[model samples]
Target: MRIGILGAGRMADALGTQWARAGHELMVSGRAPEKAAALAERIGPAARVGTFREAATFGDAVLLAIRDDGVQDVLAAAGAADGTLQGRVLVDCTNPVVPEKLTLKTAGGPSMAERVAAATRAHVVKAFNLCHEDVWRMTPPVFDGVKLAVPLCGDDPDALALVRTLVTGLGCEPIDGGALERAALLEATAAFMIGLWFSGANAQAVIPPLKYAFGAH
Candidate 1:
């Protein structure tokens, strides 16, 4: 699979490295050319660095690994070349939480994924916003006897399938999180989890077992 990543940060490094190791072709792009090149080199020989437009145009799927605030700018750059991102599956791995209070930055209007979808012609999928980058570094990302579950929300079936494949490639289970309109729930989940983590609270304990939380099945 050909994957284009739109950032040079930790999220980009972590996910890009894993995908590259899985034998996928990778192209990394960032605001800084040198930083993008550096990230591609760090991901090994299967990856290359290119301009945002080129990266967006080169992939079967594009992963937006940039900060929440910069997503629009990056997508704008990527789409500048004759609407390069049109009809592409754009996987958004961003959380719109403000660090200071762990509250959602876009608390009212639209979810980050919704905004992304509206900004471009790409099919936007919200995913990988639930955990830290280090968590993605764990081989298989399993705990106890269960594989970690990755929930994604998107409107496109094909785009969802593509993201599901990527999630499985990380050795995690892919959970259908409903339509793209529901992406705000995932963003809120991130905020809640992050707040718990920062407050030294065991967020996992807050959720009852499936039999209890969702009734006997």
Candidate 2:
């Protein structure tokens, strides 16, 4: 599979490098040519550098790994609003939250993932947003003998399948998180968990085990 990454930041580097190592062809692009080139070089021979538009056009699946505020501009530059991304699988790993406040930037409106879907008319999937980029950098991201579970929210089955494969490539499990409409929940969860993490709390411990979720029988 061919993957295109639309940012040269840590998220882009971590996910792109993992996918490249998994034998997927990758195109790394960014607003800065040097950054993109450097990232591509770091990813080794399985990856190459390209312009945003070129990268958008090059992949079967495109990862929109840019900052939330820059998403619109970058998508526009990639001709997404002009149909460059139509019918493609677009992965959204962005969290539209104000870190200090732990509040969503799109509080009363659509999720960042929804906005990306609207802007590009692509099969958008909300994923890889809950954890820090460093977590993604882990070779398999397992803990306590369990593979990390990645929740995915998307409307299209085929697109979700592709993303599930990508998730598995990193040795993680893919969790079906309902449809695109549920993405707002995931984004809000990110804000909530991030706040917990910032406060030195174990966010994962707050959730009950599956057997006790609805009370022990």
Using TM-score, give the best candidate's number. 2
lDDT of 1 by residue, 1-217 (tens): 9999889999999999998888899999999999999999999999999999988878789999999988878887887436788789999989998999888999997999998888777898999999999999888899888899999999999999999999999999999999999999999999999999988998888988777988676
lDDT of 2 by residue, 1-99 (tens): 999889999999999999998999999999999999999999999999999999998978999998899999999999997899999999999999897
- Candidate 1's TM-score reads 0.96
Q: Candidate 1 — which residues are off by over 4 angstroms?
A: 214-217
Clashing pairs in 1: none
Clashes by residue pair, model 2? none
For every candidate structure, what is the RMSD over all alpha carbons to the true structure, in angstroms?
1.4, 0.7
6 Cα displacement, candidate 2 (Å): 0.5
lDDT of 1: 0.91
